[model samples]
Target: MNKDYFKLTGEKINIEDLSREIVSDSKDEEIKKELYDELVPKLRELHAKLFAEAKYGILVVLQAIDAAGKDEIIKYIFSNLTPQGLKNTSFGKPTEEEESHDYLWRINKGLPKRGEIAILNRSYYEDIISPKIYDTLDSLPDEIKNDPELWNKRYKQLNNFEEYLDENGFKVVKFYFHVSKDEQRKRLLERIEDSTKNHEFSFSDLEDRDNWDKYQKAFEEMLNNTSTEIAPWYVLPADNPWYSRKVATLALIDVIKKINPKFPEFSAEDKEKAEKIAEQLKNKEI
Candidate 1:
C-alpha cells in the first residue's frame, strides 16, 4: 500500500477528494489471498512476540460513518488475534457517570495494558462529531456550543493525549473508513430491504444521513486537526470491503513490524540449570 494515498498527518483533507474504491473485483481476489496466506499469519506471529516481550501496546481506533465496514475489520482481522492480550471496546452515548468526568476520562480507563492490543470501535471522537451533528451537549456550559474555538481545543487535547500514550511505549493506530455518500445510501438501503439485514437498520441512521454534509465536514476537520506524527490517521476507501481490508491489513502489519517486539532472553545461570536438568534426565532414562 502506498500510504500517501490515505495517510493523513497535519495535512488538510477534503472528504470529496478521496476515492471510495480503488481496485477491481478480480484484483481483490488476489489481495484477499495474500492477506489470509501471508499478512494475517505474520500479524499473529508478531503479536506473539509482542505478548512475550510485555513491553509495548497497540491501540487501534476504528472510526467511521455508518455501515463503513468497521465490524468486518473486527470480525476478519481482530478475531484472528490471540484473545489473551486483545480487547475490543465500543463507545456510544455517555452515561451520567461518564458525563461527570472529563471527556477523556473514560477513554483513559479503557486503554490497554503493556503488550496488549485494544480496538476501540467508536471512540472519544464521538464527543466531537456526534454533538456537532446533533447539537446535543451533555452537562456542558451552554456557552461551549457557541465557542468557535472549542473544536480546535478538543483536537489539541486529543492530540496531546495520544502523544502521551506514544511516549509511554504505546502506539495509537487510527483508521477512518471513508465510504462515500452514495455507497452509504446503498448499504443503508440493503439494511432496510434485506430480511436478514433488517436488524441493522435504524431510523437514526436516516436522520444522520440527512446531515451527511455536516458529518463530512466534521470528519475532514478532524482528520486535518488531530492526525499527528506519533498517532497518524489512515483514511480507507471503504466502498469495496476487499480494498479497505487489504489496505487495513497492510497498514497493521507495517506498524507491528515497526514495533519489533522480541522474546526475552534467559540468564546464564538459568541456561546452565536447564542444561544440567537435561543431562540428568538423559542419564536417568528408563
Candidate 2:
C-alpha cells in the first residue's frame, strides 16, 4: 500500500484543493470489490488475534458531512469482525445530560475495553466543528463561548486526550470522508425522490445545506489542528464509495498489522495438560 496516498498525519490539508473524486491511482470499482472480498477474511483473523491477546484496544472514529457514506463504510468493513469483539456507536445531538458534563464525557464512556474494537460514527470532534459552524456554542459559559482562543484550546485538549489514550494502549484511527457538494446534492436528492429512503432525510440536514461553506472551513481547521501522529486522520475521497472503502480497509489492515497482536502462549505445564486432555477426548475417555 502507498502510505502517503490518503494519510494526512503531518501534512497541511486544504479541503478546496483535495479532490472528492477518486484519483487515477485508485483501484477501479471491480478491483476494489475484489480486493475488499479478499481483505475481509484477513481482517477477521487479525481481529480475532487482537481479541485473544487482550492487550491493545482499537478505536475507529469516522467523521463526515451528511450523505458521505459513513454508515455504508462501517457496515462493509466491519461485517466480518467477531460480534463480541466489536461495538459501534453513533453520535447525533448531545442529550441534556451530556451537555451537563464536559464535552469528552460521553466519548470516554464509549471507549473500547482492552482487546476490543470500537467504531464511533461521529465523535468528540463534532464539538469542535459542528457547534462552531452552527453557533451552538453561544449558550456555553462566556469563557468558552467568547474566547477567541477556544478552538486552539480545544485542539490542545484533544491532542492531550489522544496522547493519554496512546500511552494507555488504545490506538485511535480517524477518518474524514471528503464528499463534494455535487455528490452530496445527488445523494440528498436520491433520499428525497425515493420513498423508501425518505426516512433517511432529516429536516436539519436541509438547514445544514445553507452553511456548506462554513462547515467546510470548520472541517479544514479541525483536520489541520488535530491530525497528529498518534491519532492521524485519513481524508478519503468519498465520491466513489467503493474506492473509499478499499482505501479505508487497507489503512485499517496496516494499523492492525502494526499492532501485531498474537495469541497468548501457554506455560509448559499447561501445554502438556492440554495435550493429555486432547488425547483423552480423542479416545472418548474421561
List, residue by residue over 187-231, the lDDT tens digit for candidate 1. 999999999999978888888889989999999888988998889
- Cα lDDT tens digits, model 2, 89-128, are 9998889888888889899767999888899999999999
> In model 2, which runs have C-alpha deviations exceeding 4 angstroms?
23-28
Give the residue spans of candidate 1 off by over 4 A: 143-145, 277-286
Worst 10 residues of 2 by lDDT: 23-32
**Highest TM-score model number:** 2
* TM-scores vs. true structure, each candidate: 0.93, 0.95
Q: Compute the lDDT for candidate 1.
A: 0.87
